[model samples]
Target chain A: MTTKMFDRIALIGIGLIGSSIARVIRREGLAGEIIISTRRAETLARAEELGLGDRYEQSAAEAVKDADLVIVSVPVGASGAVAKEIASSLKPGAILTDVGSTKASVIAQMEPYVPSNVHFIPGHPIAGTERSGPDAGFAELFQNRWCILTPLPGSDEAAVAKLADFWTACGSNIDTMDPNHHDMVLAIVSHLPHIIAYNIVGTADDLETVTKSEVIKYSASGFRDFTRLAASDPTMWRDVCLHNKDAILEMLARFSEDLASLQRAIRWGDGDKLFDMFTRTRAVRRSIIEAGQEVDAPDFGRIAVAKPAEASQGRD
Target chain B: MTTKMFDRIALIGIGLIGSSIARVIRREGLAGEIIISTRRAETLARAEELGLGDRYEQSAAEAVKDADLVIVSVPVGASGAVAKEIASSLKPGAILTDVGSTKASVIAQMEPYVPSNVHFIPGHPIAGTERSGPDAGFAELFQNRWCILTPLPGSDEAAVAKLADFWTACGSNIDTMDPNHHDMVLAIVSHLPHIIAYNIVGTADDLETVTKSEVIKYSASGFRDFTRLAASDPTMWRDVCLHNKDAILEMLARFSEDLASLQRAIRWGDGDKLFDMFTRTRAVRRSIIEAGQEVDAPDFGRIAVAKPAEASQGRD
Candidate 1:
């Protein structure tokens, strides 16, 4: 406890991920000093008010100076600008990383601007809540979650190890994969689901026969489940959609094609197909629960205080 | 408090809805006697083990005999058979209803067989979990939820009032709509959501680009949200799909159309369109939360014990 993981850690954005890192770093004594920088003055002031960092810098370049580690947690679309802004100030031998969802694009954006001495390891800690801002973070956001580090080939082994160890201490287990594979995997697992959630919510919102009040009133049936994902931050999701366009498009095409087939089955009243498809999906959830990637509680553990109206009752 | 809602209530299917009704009847002392019946002897035996009813009957007709109220909680496809079996055995002027999802189909199925003397009011308590069988039922299953009734024209008003009072006592607000309207409303709110969820899960499972293990491992991201709805009772949902074909197809068509537009926007990199669509949907979830139909807690109140990995971290 006497020794910190880094002499100083600079966070270049203080939203959910950055603030969570700050809170965890403070709680775990991971750094001697935390330097926070964000684009907006209001957000930076809020982070300072929350004591998220020992020092607040208006310029990301200033924040990275003398810091042993720098985490760029901005929107992926803004990664290039942030990298360019802070490139000259990054200390030699400092470990630089990002918590962007799309690794290939982030690497594409930031890798060119990185100095030769700086270790630019692209890492994504697969943990967070839907809420944003400095106040929305807690120290335990990464506990028992996976932190995937898509380090470039031939990167410094010791730097990667150090970053992995730091994330482990932050409460995440480490996994490594190719950046493209991460994009494909995340497109299916995260991007497609979020897009579908947003699309369905939009669809439900546009209905004329079904009142919005009716939709909200009776959301407990199944609609409420999608609403959670749809309620996520728009700008972040927009950046994600833009940054991971090809992968997301590929997944969306597949989803739409599969949906067309399912639509055919429903229109034709193919009960067997519907039953088999529905039955097969049940096991994925079971596997997810077994893997500890999800809660075992029915209805996301909300049934104890369930208030969803017009739920689909089970069969006899 | 001393007076029961019904002298005797016959539950002709001891699954989620039927068993929950039985449990609420016991908890609230709404019925003098509860007669549980199902197609399977094992289910009836299980219901008996759970003490969900005062007496267990293999034959629904036998169960409905001398009963003042009969609730057919079978799948929509089986409503006709259940109504036929119990029609002749129903006590004169007894109240008969159902908890089927598709009201028009259930009414069409059960109406022909119902005797004139009995009040054949079709109903659906828009409440349930993905679980099935007698053990899944809880007394609070319908608490603060909506139970919609679609009564045929010229039906006895006093009988309707009594049924409404019974559901109210069991802790559900009452909604009355035409069978066709109920189908349309539910098609968008419940049926479409379930279908889309099932389709997405199927799409994820069939992907050669992403392994099933990876999907499950990273499900806490956004995919896990859909898996809960996808894990619902296959038979019940299959029946819902088959029985509500018209409305399901209608909503599915609309959903597909919206999805196609969203797809176009994504493919074209129309950030403004995507942002606007995503922004509009956020209000629906907020409205749902304010309406008490959804958990206001982020991630469906699961973050207190969040396990989803690869979560989309918020913006800077």
Candidate 2:
């Protein structure tokens, strides 16, 4: 095992991301003691049952009492509450961070209550699946994914390095960015996509003419892809929508404006405009594949093509 | 093998769908002879090199001659032109169909040129990956997928039944609907999703604030899913947008309107509203999975979870 980064690490809100951190910390031996805490008693119980941590605390405050590292992994909207709860009990010189999607809001919510002696950094891991809860997480979720850290300008470099090292040990590539830029980047990459997916799925569900069965049955054509994102944890996404209001609105406005132009092109039968937009987007997917952000397999390698039991095999 | 369903099957457009048809037909022994054709001579040559058919012809008309079954798998906008070109050469009593996404437009385009004695059924197999072209085709492309047929009233029932049987042999479940209804269903299920995907990808591409490399690097959060659909064949999607203009416009209107309300909720910090919409959409995804239209795997089962080499097991 690698060297331990902290004597104790407190995980507040044991959801998918939090549980994943617990698993990875154990796997990598990053923390001497892991403390899991959640607002919901049942969730804490579930985490205990899953053996996610060395200690279980019903109070976020209690969880951070002796911890050298405290990571808030709750909904963005709950960051402030979690921060306020743990503020007084935080150990001096402890490094505080969050895995929220919106860095600016998380910082805004978390930084105020943090003790002057504690090093508070805001981080957003650009990794997740649509699944949520402790059960949905796995140790390898962060492998080959990005973890963006938005450290305050005056924060201690040693504290920041220690936190970055912890994430690197969890198998993520690290990038540091300004909080606002992180928010903007995430608004387009994460928030807008989830919002659009939820909106489209809701629209399809509300259709009067089309039956739900028909939509589900023919979903493989394109709709099922949106459904995967739409099925993501609602509470977490709602918090993102509420917390990252400005950037998400900006991205949404741009998206709608571009969509209007596309709609106009369709209305006027401007095939060239449609073709150009469609063609340009293909390169982005290729770039993503090239960047190792996506799997190179066709259809993300989801389908296993069935071969004929016996056939004249020389055809292809 | 299965009894031969036709004397000769002509595939007019050896792209993803057409080439898959060729592969499946060869595997199932559905046709005694397979004739492949494409507008591009290179595509025809590639299909021949892949041994996708017994005969490869650059002329759609030549490929359809003496063929008992002719499948035109071209972009929706090209349906009319292909129908016109192959009209004189189409064999009497032959079942002719085109696997185009927009059924009403395809039917309207191709029906005028179809000979009265030939059965011209419009079909769409709701199965494909982001990849296109002859090389991307596989025999199991249609396995467990829905194939919708929009047959004109007073069309030959025997020919329709035969075509349905052929698709079944190709591993597709069949559904018959009125052409207009099919268009509306596809507008929601297929067309709208692709349009939304294209629009979002275009919006991301045009962003000056976020670098393209950053977008590519951080895509796994959610943007990559949209990229997959947006990266689809440009020509085919362009045709879909142009051909199904009315239905697409209607769906787009609804999508935009719903998005506006969602945007407002975010602006007003209405977490309850956001949560409700997100929570409701999750059920639709569950329904799709239950209906066997989607895999019930988290993250689409794309990422294999890496297990710790040693850990206390039996947690689940």
Candidate 3:
């Protein structure tokens, strides 16, 4: 493990990303003492039960006091509130960063509250599962994942390097980009995909011709892949949608236009057009697999086991 | 293993599904001899090299000459031509089936050419990976997966039972439904998901705001999952879209309407609506997992591996 980079590191919002940070900090000995805090009492209690930190606090303001580094990990919508809550408590010269999905909105939300003496860098780890909450995190969560840091132009280089070191110790590869550019990239790669997944699942649920049970039964064919993203944390995703409206809307418009063209191809029996489009997309998956972004297994290497009793309900 | 279901089984179009059937039939001793055929010479040669069948033939007619069971596993659009090519050569009392995703269309395409003496039953196994071709097949591909049979109203009961038995021996649970209903069920569960995935990937590729390298680098966030389905067999999916046009179009309309509402919710910052829609979709995924239709593990149980050299190319 690396030598402790900070005497005390406070973690605000002990949800999936927060708890993951706690675990990694502890695993890598990145901080001499870690303080965990969240708004919800049960979540705080759960983190304590899991022994996720050296100390647990119910108040973010209390958690930040005396910390050399503070990482805020909350829903994007709540970043500003958390910043306001902990603004006065932030230690001078401390590096304060957030693990929110949207960087531009986060920088805007927290920058006003951050003390001029403090170094506030906005970051996002482009990695997650469908699950949420304290129990859903592990030290290995960030391994091989990209953690993008969108630092302001005038930010202190030394503090940025320190924070980058902490993340590097946690097993992430770092990339730095402009906050607005980060938002646009994530809009297509993350936010839009989740939105599309949620929309499709909602459509299937509301279908009058096809029963819900049929959708569930036959999901393995293809639909289940979309469901994984749709089942992500609702509050977090809702906040993302609200915070990154322009980028998400722009990406969504492009997606719809493309869908209309594909729909026309199917309707008009344009097999060549469909074939060419489908063929071109295959290379993207290959590149992802080759880049080590995706697993190189069919169906994500899912193994079929005996059917559960619930499976019988859907069968005729 | 079960008693030999047929003296000889002819598999036409030895791609993912066809070669998989060949492997399972060999594994289970379901047929005394297996004959594989495809219009493409290289695929037939590869199937032979893979030892997928006891005999190989370039002509579908020759392949089914003395086969007691015949499975046409080509694209749905090719069902008619394949059926016509092998019709006169099909053995008396032989059971003929196709594993096409779209049932009504396949039946309509092939039923007119089937001889009165040959039993024609249209079947669809709701199992596959994004990977295709002979190299992608596996013996256990159908294990515990649902296989639906949509036989004609007056199809011989014994013939249907025998085909069902053959699938059972290959480790599938059987469900029988009307061809039209099967088409509708599949439209929402399989066709729409593939179409949406293909559309989104195409959109990302065509984006001017976000570079292709950025999308590939940040894909693990969510976009990577869609790419797997998007990268599926172009000919097969194209045929599915064209053949199941009515059901697909109907589902697409519903999907577009739901997406519009979701887009509005995002535009209006309707957190409650977004949260409710997102929350309801989680239950569908849970049900699928409970029904043994999907793996319960997070991120499809993918293990994070060391980043490959190619991954560095996309980084700034």
Candidate 4:
């Protein structure tokens, strides 16, 4: 693992994930030279100020030229455009990947634009914070997180392994699945949560019954939990919703169906049903904690640290 | 300010809220004697072990005997029964109050049992964690939170003010609203969030398509945020659902409608609509932060300290 995985690694969008990769590449010496290209002039300037790359270019084509590895870490909706911008200049056999939320859409948007000479492997590093932009990223952002790669069928296995190794070096565990499965799983795990968060926050905003002041003052009661997800990069989430339409809709249908049943239980005063559903859900939280995906508290990733009382433990 | 708010304070149901009030009573010396009562023997013993009260009793009637103030901190469904148990034992001119989520239902259920000699006031402290039971309480649990009182018409203003004063000493801001309005507001802000979290987590749990391990491992992507609310006390949440049916239903219906619209937007690739919603919700988070109601993170209240990255405010 000497610092020379590739002679040049090009990052086409220096936002949260992109700048994060830049930091890790710099720290781990993963690439001899890091070329950064972003659409926004300010962002490019900021990345340069942050010393995020060895070379900064406004043109994606210029950044990708002669680069052995090129990662387009833009929003899913921009994948096609970025792919098209850099495709002609991509070096032969160069591995081109993306860090997008929706895989099927990213593949669909980017696949046709990728030249046959390049190894086009779509990827999603399931790591981020609510913040965005070049300054919001850090080298340790991907630590212990999951990165899923949806390489095309009949694609070179060696190329896929190489990308996986790159993510591994950046502190992520790698997993592979079909793009469709990835979309469905993500619809439930990532996309749905973000959508629900945005929806609930919107509902609160439109509320006339509860004064806006009251919603803000009493948010810690539970409403605030959704706010962080709700406050994520609007452009990115919008793209996620637009790109992963069918899977997201399917997940939303299932979610609404389950919600309707739960609502029925509440309406009928079915304590047993409510209790059963609530109790069962607790197990999933515990499993997530055991699997190291979540912390073992009702308020994870917050400023308050509550110690669990032994006597508070019940069967549920 | 000197902490002698009542001659004696009886807490009838030493769960999280009950024990929290008890802790505050002890810390502030607000009561000459703190009498704690719950139906469960184990909980009573645990409260005694924790020194949460000056006296521990299984009978609500016995606990209320000779007490000048009584706080019924129980599930909404149990409010009537607890009121009945302590009705005869309530001292004349005593201020009788309750900490129930659904103020309207609690008032309806318990109003009949409160004798004319006692001043009955219903209040809801908009603060809690997912954990419950006597041992899960702390004196500062209500600090900087909202404590809403929904008093019946023509109720004793002095008694209501005194209760408000007590909550203030425990570090909560006070708000007064109609009982039905309080329930509706709570339905949207708290009840619905819990229900949705429980429902979504349940749906993910029942998915046969995605392996449980995959869901757990990738949960950090977003799904883990829902688990904290889903892991909240089952009995308390079940009672809330049953008692706050109308308000919860109203909010749930509205939530569903909004979600359907969002789904339609996603399906139609309406990125602008999604972006607008996401952007609007960010303002709510900002308001909550300014109101000091929430920490600036998704999984808040779980961690004692935020990462330094959160403090600097630059990353995504």
Best by DockQ: 3
Give the worst 10-residue stretch by lDDT in candidate 4 chain B: B307-316
Off by over 4 Å in 4: A1-4, A300-316, B297-316
TM-score of chain A of each: 0.95, 0.95, 0.95, 0.94
For model 1, name the residue pairs that clash. A126-B310, A220-A308, A310-B126, A311-B126, A311-B127, B220-B308
lDDT of each: 0.85, 0.87, 0.88, 0.84
Candidate 2, residues B266-301, lDDT tens digits: the string is 999998899999999988988887887776666522
Error of 4 at A288 (Å): 1.1
Which runs in model 1 stand beyond 4 Å of their true positions?
A: A305-316, B1-3, B305-316
Model 3 lDDT, full chain set = 0.88
Candidate 3 residue-wise lDDT, A1-316, digit = tens: 5578899999998877888789888888889999999999998998898899999999899999999999999999999999999999999999999999999999889999999999999999888778788877767778888999999989999998998888899899999999999999999999999999999999998888889989998898889999999889999999999999999999988899899999999889999999999999988988998887886667532652222232221210
TM-score of model 1 (CA atoms): 0.95
RMSD of each predicted structure: 5.7, 6.6, 4.7, 5.9
Docking level of model 3: medium
In candidate 1 chain B, what residue range of length 10 has the lowest lDDT sum?
B307-316
Structure candidate 4, residue pairs in collision: A131-B316, A132-B316, A135-B314, A136-B314, A136-B315, A136-B316, A299-B302, A300-B299
**Lowest summed lDDT over 10 consecutive residues: which window, candidate 2 chain B?**
B307-316
